[model samples]
Target: MKFYISTLGEFDIKVDGQSILRDSNRMYRIYKLFEYFLTFRNKKLLPETIIDNLLSDSESEDPKNMLRTQIFRLRKIINALIPKGELPEKYMNLNFTNGYYCLEIGENTIVDIDVFENLIQKGDKEREYDIESAIESYQNAISLYKGLYLSDNAYEVWLVPTRNYYQRLFLKTLNKYIDLLKRNEENEKIVNLCEKSLLIEPFEESIHIELIEALLKIGQNKSAMQHYEYALNMLEKELDAKPSAKFINYINIIQNYTSRNNDLDIEAINKSLEEELPEGAMYCSLEYFKFLFNLQKRKSKRNNEYDYLLSIMINSNNNKSINDVFSVLKKSLRKGDVFTSWNDNQILVMLHNVKENGTETIKERLTDNLINYTRINRNEIRLIFQPVSMENTIL
Candidate 1:
């Protein structure tokens, strides 16, 4: 007789071809005992340990007796579920000796977690030598990780560590598999793998970055930008934090490459800037902001003009879009200054020939303008003036 126990997404058992559902009190407790015993099947557990792991919350005063009764119930259920003479005598019995209980297993019994671990080991061993076989093994293992382990028992403290351990293993195996795909220059496969991984770990920044990079490699800049925006919004909303500098630089690269039309001569490039005024902040893309910032640094070194970068994030009592805040900023800031949206909620501004005190005055004027022009409350607008030198980068 073949018995299968699956604990990856949910705790389920199949005896032969029929599944055991939790439809009866006897069946439910039997399932719990079977699951607990299979989880540590190789070891003989004391009644206290088994009770603690399986029935720690039970209201029964004498858990040792309860555990003995559960073992008996488990044996009866196994006997009735499996046909007569189908399972070996050893497999049919719940062995209790010297105050220890164990679920004796037969050769035909299978557990999904054990199979998953074995496949991972095989994949790791074969990846360098045989790519196709390794990928097959990895795919098999990845499919086994349907979702969080013992998801029905997610809040159980005892399950947390085991769940996290399996999760880490799954991710490690997946990342290695992805690296192998990358070695084969399988960009589409890389994107697919990243998307699959993200389904399980949606907030994983590394996976998101990898997906974006893969899409960019295939000239899918628009798709990559959409993912970037999604990731940016998700991270900010969930973690109250920004993405890493590496991620922002990747965005800058994508935008810079996508925005290029053709090579322009020095005179044409110079003429493009002729209409811009010298004082109010100029709005630009992240790529353009980076270029102008570098240009300003070079010019500052030669001309001895002190240039600084300031970051502004509106603290609005009501949520407002970046365009609304930018409208107020355009009317308030100096004409020669430049600015760009670091994200939807923040802006990076370049101020030329400004000292510490000048920034304070600029902050006050911007605050007043935001409240007066946009009707945002004065207390709801916050101006953060972080002075960045020519040698530094700001996001």
Candidate 2:
């Protein structure tokens, strides 16, 4: 019987087109054993190594005995996959010889990870001679990576290195494939490929850069700008760091793209620039807020105006969502004020031209509005204010 094993994104064993091993709480331990064995099939593994990797956290007094019991259970499960009359030993073997245990499977079994590596090798070999053939091989290999390796076992410490290795290999192969496509002037294909790769590696700055470059190549300037904003926000929010210089350079490219469009009249340009029925306070991206804050600082110094930066820190245990607080801020503040989420539990607001005493009054007003709108206790919200100047760093 043919055994098809999948272990890249998930764990599964299909015998002759029938799924036998499934994800279930009752069979988790046994399934993990089977998966580990299958991953290192035909290799002699010592009992100590297996126990340390699999049962290191267990409270059992005798893990060796526990391992034996689990192995026996796994053998039963494997035997059930064989035909009614065939001997299970002919198809699979879990044997302990000397001081090591080994799992041997018949040649009929096919594993996805093996196939994925083979395809990558094939692509590399063909890359020097046949670009088209190499691209096809790389595409097939990339398609096999549905997600991170063993994504279901994300929290397993032993799987971390293996997972990172596969992910790096995937990103490397994908970048090579994208380079081949770029050489062929296949911008559309590069766009599609990078977009899909982003789903698998969303935080990968290189993939985002590739996608934005491809979009720019196809003259999709607007789409490129939109993706730039998304990438910027994602990096800031998820990683708590600014993007690299290579990524920040895209903003200049986008600006150049906009400046090249000379077909519009002054009236149309003004119409496009105007906001539709301006609301209470303007909400901007953190990056844009930084620029505004800096500009306001310079203006405040020159005009001798009193501008304040107010920070609202929300308690983590509050029942109200951060969005609820943001909504209230958008309506409660004046039209000249601006705000952005400083972090997961905090927001920073720029209050323009407020008198020394106005800080207290505005703080009270916002506190009251938040309490009334969110019905949250006053103690759960903390607001701090400082004059907007060169000394203050909002970013």
Candidate 2: list runs displaced more than 4 Å: 15-18, 84-91, 257-395
Which pairs clash inside model 2? none
The TM-score values for the models, in the order shown, are 0.62, 0.67
Instruction: Report the C-alpha lDDT of model 2 over 26-127, residue by residue, as the tens digit.
Output: 898998888778767889999999999999999999999999999999988877777788765567778889989998876666788888999999999999
Query: How many clashes in each candidate?
Result: 8, 0
Model 1, which residues run further than 4 Å from truth? 15-18, 24-29, 89-93, 240-245, 256-395
Highest lDDT model number: 2
Worst 10 residues of 1 by lDDT: 271-280
Error in Å for residue 222 of model 1: 0.7
Q: Which candidate leads the pack in TM-score?
A: 2
- Per-residue accuracy of model 1 over 204-322 as CA lDDT, tens digit each: 78888888878877876556665665466545544568777887567676565455521355554353334222234556678656655654555465446666787877665556646
